[model samples]
Target: MTTKTRAAEIDALLKELYPRAEIALRFESDFQLLVAVILSAQTTDVSVNKVTPVLFDRFPDARALAGADPAEVEEIVHPTGFFRNKTKNIIGAAQRIVAEYDGRVPDTMEDLLTLPGVARKTANIVLYNAFGKAEGIAVDTHVFRLAHRLGYSSEKDANKVERDLMALFPREEWGALTYRLIEHGRAICDAKRPICGQCALADLCPSAFTVNGWREQA
Candidate 1:
């Protein structure tokens, strides 16, 4: 089959596996979501979720976060790891949002990039989830790993992998597809040891029972 055909099959399988694929990180507002995503880097969604309640309660919005005490922010976000840097980026991002965007999280990719710690991955998450715009697929660690293992892309770089996926899947499925891939990664196609036997996509996955010494493990 052609790459497009294979990609379509993978997409279908993922949709079946995750009928209600959604963002796991909980947030009520755009700014809150942006802050949550920033804290999510190098950390789990569960970890970010745990600290956000206190963080948001302390600094409710852009205006509040912009003037938040760095020490206080660090203490709250300490569980997410990289507390010092994340505190800096989250506060800096809030300051920029309040000053430049009139206290609203920038909806466009270009405007969102202006904020600190807002890279394509984080920007894509905020844009798609907050603004309902699918500018590009959010290639996080799970997406990156699954994209390569599924024969979607051989490129090691996340951007390149995202480009390959964008080319494979239609634009409309970009955001939903990303969430499904991430969920699948967590459920079955893990980094160290994928449970090929229980995986729904095992038959279609190029690396199934082959990659990462699955044959020996299985």
Candidate 2:
């Protein structure tokens, strides 16, 4: 089958399996979502969610966060890992938002990229979840692993994998596709040991037959 056909099948099966797939990071506002995504780098959604309540309670908005003590921020977000760098970037991003965007998280991808610690993944997350925009696919570790294993892309880099997915899938499905693939990765196509035999997309997945209880066959 053609890549496009395979992509359609994958999308259909993923939708069936995860009709309610979404950004798992919990937040009440765009600013909170932006902060959560930034802290999510190199961390899990559960980890980010765990720390956000305390962090948000203390520094509720960009204006408040901008003036927050770095030590206090670090103390609150230390569980997310990379506490020091995350503190600096979140604080810096807050300062920029307060100064330039009137304390609002920028909606555009280019503008979002200007924030400290915001990359394409974080920018895409903010754009899609915060503003209902689809600038690009959010290629997190799950997406990166699944893209290659599913024969969607041979590229090792996240940006290149995202480009390959963009070429195969329609623009409208970009955001949803990202979350579905992430869910699939977490549920079945795990990096260490994929439960391919029980995977919903096993029929369409190239690596499915090769995966056993432990890992993908060489």
Candidate 3:
């Protein structure tokens, strides 16, 4: 299939399989989402969710978070792993949000990137979830793996994969597309062992049933 046709088919399959896919991070507001996203780096959503209630209770907004002690923040987020660095980034990001953005999370990618610890992925999450902007695809691990396995892109780097996906998909579907792929990856196309036989996109997936000699059946 052509790349465009493949993208469309994958898109349809993803929507059918994960119709309700949305942000997994538990947050009450944009600032909370930002902090949750930061803590989610290299950590599971379950872990982040476990710690964020107390963290958010202690520091409800950018102003409160900006004034919080780094040590206390680290202690609160310790369970998320990389607590020290995450604390620094969260506090630094909050400080920048208060100082520069008037205590509101910036919606645009460029402005969001100006905040400390705000990379393209985090910025994209905020823009898409918090502000309803669909600037480009957020190529996290799920999107990265699914894109290659579905024959959509072969780039190893997240940014390159993001770029390739942006070229392949419409701008409007970018946000939902990535979210659906993430849901699919978690539920079906797992990294270590994908449940290909039951996957809705198995027929379309280039890597589906390839492990365990199932490709021989193909």
Candidate 4:
């Protein structure tokens, strides 16, 4: 099958496997979602979620977080790892949003990128989830791993992998595909010990049954 057809088939199976797939981060507003996404860098969504309830409770909005003391914010977000930098970025981002964006998370990728700690991956997630705009795909660790394993792209850069995926899937499906791929990665296609035998896409996956040899010891 052609790459496009193969990609569609993979997406079809993923959509079925995770029909209700959604971003696992818990947030009630765009600002909160932005904070949660930044906090999620190199950290699990579950871990970020655990700290955000307390983080948001104290610094409820961009205006509030903009003026928060670094030490206090550090204490609250310490569990997410890289606390020092994460605190700095989130607080700086909040300050910028309040000072320039008028306390609202910028909807456009350009405007979003101007903020501290916001990159294309984070911008894509915020744009899609917060505003339902699919300008691009968010390539997290899972997406990067899955893209190569599934024969979608050979690029080492996440942005290049995202571009390859965008060429294959419809724009509207871009956001949804990310969630489903991440869900599949976390659920079955683990980086260390993928449960390939139970993966619904094993029949179609090029790397299937090849990388899970380490699972025998588990």
lDDT order of candidates, top first: 1, 4, 2, 3
lDDT of 1 by residue, 1-218 (tens): 88799889888988988999899998999999999999999999999999999999999899999999999999999999999999999999999998999999999999999999999999999999998999999999999999988999999888899899999999999989989999999999889878888887877877875776655676
| Least accurate 10 contiguous residues by lDDT in model 2 | 209-218
- Tens-place lDDT digits, model 2, residues 1-218: 99889989989999999999999999898999999999999989999999999999999889999999999999999999999999999999999999999999989988998999998999998899988899899999999999988999999888999899999999999999999999998988889988876777877888775667323442
TM-scores for all predictions: 0.96, 0.96, 0.96, 0.96
Candidate 3: tens digits of C-alpha lDDT, residues 1-218: 78888789879877887889998999999999999999999989899999999999999999999999999999999999999999999999999999999999988999998887889999999999999999888888888998888888888889998999999989889888888989988998889888777777877777875755556765
Per-residue error for 1 in candidate 2, Å, reads 0.8
TM-score of 4: 0.96
Q: Which pairs of residues collide in candidate 4?
A: none
Candidate 1: where is the Cα deviation over 4 Å? 212-218
Stretches of model 3 off by over 4 angstroms after superposition: none
Which residue pairs clash in candidate 3?
A: none
What is every candidate's alpha-carbon RMSD to the true fold? 1.5, 2.1, 1.2, 2.4
Model 1: number of backbone collisions? 0
Q: List the residue pairs that clash in candidate 2.
A: none
What is the model-wide C-alpha lDDT for candidate 4? 0.92
Clashing pairs counted in every model:
0, 0, 0, 0
